[model samples]
Target: MSLENNKIFASVLTAGILLMASGFAAKSLYHPKDLEENAFKIEVSDSGVEVASAGAEEPSIEPISALLATADVAAGESGFKKCASCHTIESGGSNKVGPALWDIVGRGRAAVDGFSYSDALQGMSSEAWDYEALNEFLAKPKDYAPGTKMGFAGLKKVEDRANLIAYMRMQSDSPAALPQ
Candidate 1:
């Protein structure tokens, strides 16, 4: 490697070591004074991400739609309520703040008409909203499609994401789950 590359690599290594050391010191210093309150932790799931308490004993809260087809449709539509502000639900509806939601499930990114999309989103080449891509997008829209206009923080609840996906699928003409 070049000398410049070595310098960059060393700087990154030093920063990582410093950060990890600081985190360990902070944990040791605060773990005792910190209250034993449980907080949510994030984890990756087969479909998307799931959250659970750091140390609390609780039953599994896997989204109902993740396993139950009937529940998925309900959750999906209900979840879309949060997204209605920027998107219109009607098929072929005029663009809202964002592109129209018509037939988006199996459609390619940046494929909408009339509406001006961010180069960030319009630049994406993802062919369509497949399950895996959709899950990641919903998990964190801004991150998955960086520079996209979506400002959603993400659905913290697995069920909410699953349900929302179910709802979107139904909205698409692609013969998704029949209306619940």
Candidate 2:
């Protein structure tokens, strides 16, 4: 090889060797064979607890029927601010990142005009919006409808979900009657 080519090749070879040596040295130094376990344990009890067995499904949260009685529409409207970025709750509103949510509480899933829904959500078109379903869905949209395109992480609070549903119920001219 020419003198310049030889020098370049030597430099490349040295770099590769140094990189490999550094990785090997870091691996040995960070995790020695004689390292002690540093994890802490917290004791738990099963008394009066409904613990699911391994490989068994855990129980879903209680129905939203109970929460509806105490639902605060004002609180729900405030909570909906997070959703406003993607959806417009105003009647006759145009679709944004998500479908306008006017009358959504009683509307069929994926029934919005002009807005395209993910296949995961479209598959649930047979179901109408109801308190329990809305509750479960708002708790975790992705978990409720796997593969859904909604980017929301979901509201973790039951009161928030109830309030949001209440606010949604108010958006409709003839809102579906609330569940007892």
Which model scores highest in lDDT?
2
TM-score of each: 0.57, 0.71
Task: Give me the candidate number with maximum TM-score.
Answer: 2
Error of model 1, residue 131, in angstroms: 1.3
Candidate 2 root-mean-square deviation in Å: 8.1
lDDT of 1: 0.72
Q: Residue 139 in candidate 1 has what lDDT?
A: 76
For candidate 1, the TM-score is: 0.57
Quality of model 2 by C-alpha lDDT: 0.88
Off by over 4 Å in 1: 1-71, 176-180
- Model 2 lDDT per residue over 40-151, tens place: 6444466655555569886686678888878999999999899999999998999999999999987899999788899999999999988888898898899899899998
Query: Would you list the clashing residue pairs of candidate 1?
Result: 75-163, 76-163, 76-164
**CA lDDT of each prediction against the hidden true structure:** 0.72, 0.88
